[model samples]
Target: MYETKTIKEKIKLFFIIFFPILITQVSLNLMTFFDTVMSGQAGAIDLAGVAIGSSLWVPVFTGINGILLAITPIISQLLGARSYDSLAKKVQQAIYLSMILAIIIIILGGLFINPILNMMNLESEVRFISKYYLISLGLGIIPLFIFNTLRCFMDALGQTRVSMIIILIALPINIILNYLFIFGKFGFPELGGIGAGIATSLTYWLTSILAILIIHKMKPFKEYQVFSAWVKPKTKHWKEQLKIGIPIGFAIFFETSIFAAITLLMSEYNTNTIAAHQAAMSFSSLLYMIPLSVGMALTITVGYEVGAKRLNDAKAYGYIGISGGIFIALLNGMILFLFNDYVASLYNSDPDVIALTVQFISFAIVYQLADAFGAPIQGALRGYKDVNMTLIIALVSYWGIGLPTGWLLANFTSLEPFGYWVGIIVGLSTGAGALLVRLRYVQKKYDKQQNPSVD
Candidate 1:
């Protein structure tokens, strides 16, 4: 029987886990903003290319990211039970198994970059620029895979701060690279869009190498098979990971693809509108990191408790995380809404772009709120390893509601750009509601077993 933690303790645990992840997320997401701004400074055509290129390949990366990220929760759960053998196999298997998948994505994304851009019907300049960015982006896929694996390892072992430090250390270097390459300073070529990709790629590789070094040298964590030379992939065990990971991949893909699909759909509105929309989306995603990190911590704590057969603790932690998320989201949404104009200025300078961005901020605000409500609920589910059904919920909410509403509002209705945002709000709310209901039912049922009445 596990004792439940007080709300204050849960909040403290959440933040200790959150600040590090928040730092990591702020660095990671800033890359997106910086990537666009550097390219935008080069030309609108450069920015357009990035948009198109991102639309084409982001879903692919989402699938890969989700699968690889599965390692974290698995390791978290296993650690709860002190199962070092299972943890070692899972870590080793994930590292070796993911390399093959990453290579496939690299090759496929590399090969089809041009064709995909053309298919999107972007301008010739945009297509060319997109191809350049895609090549560098594709080249960086393996490095990202390696980096994420290490981050997951560290995060699972309860030191999410290590990943944050690596990201922060690499950030200054990334910024310098972009400045030099994008503008052709210091006798370097004006690589433009390619420069943004190259800078990001270099950062990925650098951070990954540093994570490798940390894992090898760190106390407590270095004893695992992941660090041992003899820890090779046992092919038979790949299925075990795939079972947990594949659904996660599709779960992530389902949500991310909806965004990508909407972006492509939104392009038909107007370039300025699309540009403003993208800017707001980027800012919103960055703001989203706070609640997202909260959700991640919830997933970790819930998994740990559940693994230890402390179901009451797991359920209590889930509510605490979710409540904290709501509070954080409301505060964040208000600030972002209040500072919409100033926030938009951080990314681009054009007045026309800034004007469109204001409306986009409203949508972004709603997403932050809805994400707070939904994300932790989903996080708890992930902690429970109930992935397949969540994918179904996402599919229905996103495709069934989100896609159609966006299309109607953006194209057919008088809402124009606001309609597009409204569509997102509706989608997020629907998904958030469904997820909450499911979480309640699941938690309640599980708690009965974990906390049965004495006869």
Candidate 2:
């Protein structure tokens, strides 16, 4: 009985899903941007500390929670298939899995992060502040994952506005808290870079708690009956979730971890070097949220089509999403390339930092092109329930090709951080090329399977 939508209608629907997710992503990255700016105001050392701390934990955060992210695609497909009866149970299983992951993160990452910092050979002051920053941020790991689980659930159902609004509300609070705690305002102890950690942690708890309350009370969520029953952790659910999620997690880890490793390597240079890297990386990351949101939308759209047994429609959505991503990426890259210096100045007033930032942003601009192609295709693949291949491809691209090239160039040549940036470009291009080819193969294969009489 459902009427088919025209291409224009589909595109509009994509943006409706995309913009809220984009807002949420922009808000999330802005939190980090604000943190870096606040710490930079404190001093070069503070900025470096926060940067290094971020470099260490961002990967861990992404990798661990990345698994839970699979819930979005899984649920989206189920919804498309009209398999409403099991939605609540599946959501419960994801929450239970998230809790287990959180505990492990706290025990391993929180308790034993110091040894890893020690091995990095950071300056004593930088090491001291980074340690506390990571630990303070670690305190909110549970709430963070809980928030992610719920957000993914809502987003898959095309209800992204709530999370966007919640994060928007939290952003200013985090900035205010950063100012108060970092500068010893309102009789609070001045914690500098560590203050950013506390501020972000508090924001995480607040947002997660709000999400839970809203989900429980919202009229829309009432149909899902997420809270109607308590289902104990089941082995089959655990295995299935893990089977889908672990590859997704590692894929994220491979991409993020290489960048983290580069940051660690840059520590040998100086605080100024690390500060500049943070500025450029943060800005680039902000731009990346565009394609990322587009890709996420693709995952939902494609998965829904696949589940609804609309294979041809899924192929069309995949191509439409990829084309949109590339166009936006090129636009973003041009802007960054054109205004790199002006943008860098906004992060810090330090001349050396700004100069370095300009250079790094140039590469970031180029990097966006590859990111555009790769990110959306990966999202499309997720919709197809094809993730293990992504993991394999990521490993080959990032570790096999990217890291070794960066290490050799940075250590033995004059490129330094630039060398690492070059590696990123190479790795992203490799992955993008391979993914696009793979997606074409998948689409054709699926089409063939769906229509045996097709030429």
Would you estimate the TM-scores of all the predictions? 0.95, 0.97
Q: Model 2, which residues run further than 4 Å from truth?
A: 1-4
Cα lDDT tens digits for candidate 2, 1-455? 12137787777777788889999999998988888889888888888899999988888888887799899888988988999899899998999999889999889985678888998868899998899988889888899999999999888888888889999999999999999888789999999999999999999999999989888899688778897788888979878878888998999899989999999888787778888998899889889888888888888888888888898778777878889998999899889988998988877889999999999999898988999889999999989888998999999999899888888888789997799999988988998898888888888778878898765
lDDT of 2: 0.87
Model 1 TM-score (2 dp):
0.95
- Model 2 poorest 10 in a row by lDDT: 1-10
Off by over 4 Å in 1: 1-5, 451-455
Candidate 2 pairs with clashing backbones: none
Measured by TM-score, how close is model 2 to the native structure?
A: 0.97
The collision pairs in model 1 are none
Q: Against the hidden true structure, what lDDT does model 1 obtain? A: 0.79
lDDT of 1 by residue, 78-174 (tens): 8778777767667777888778888888778767766655666566777787788878876677878988877887887768888899999998898
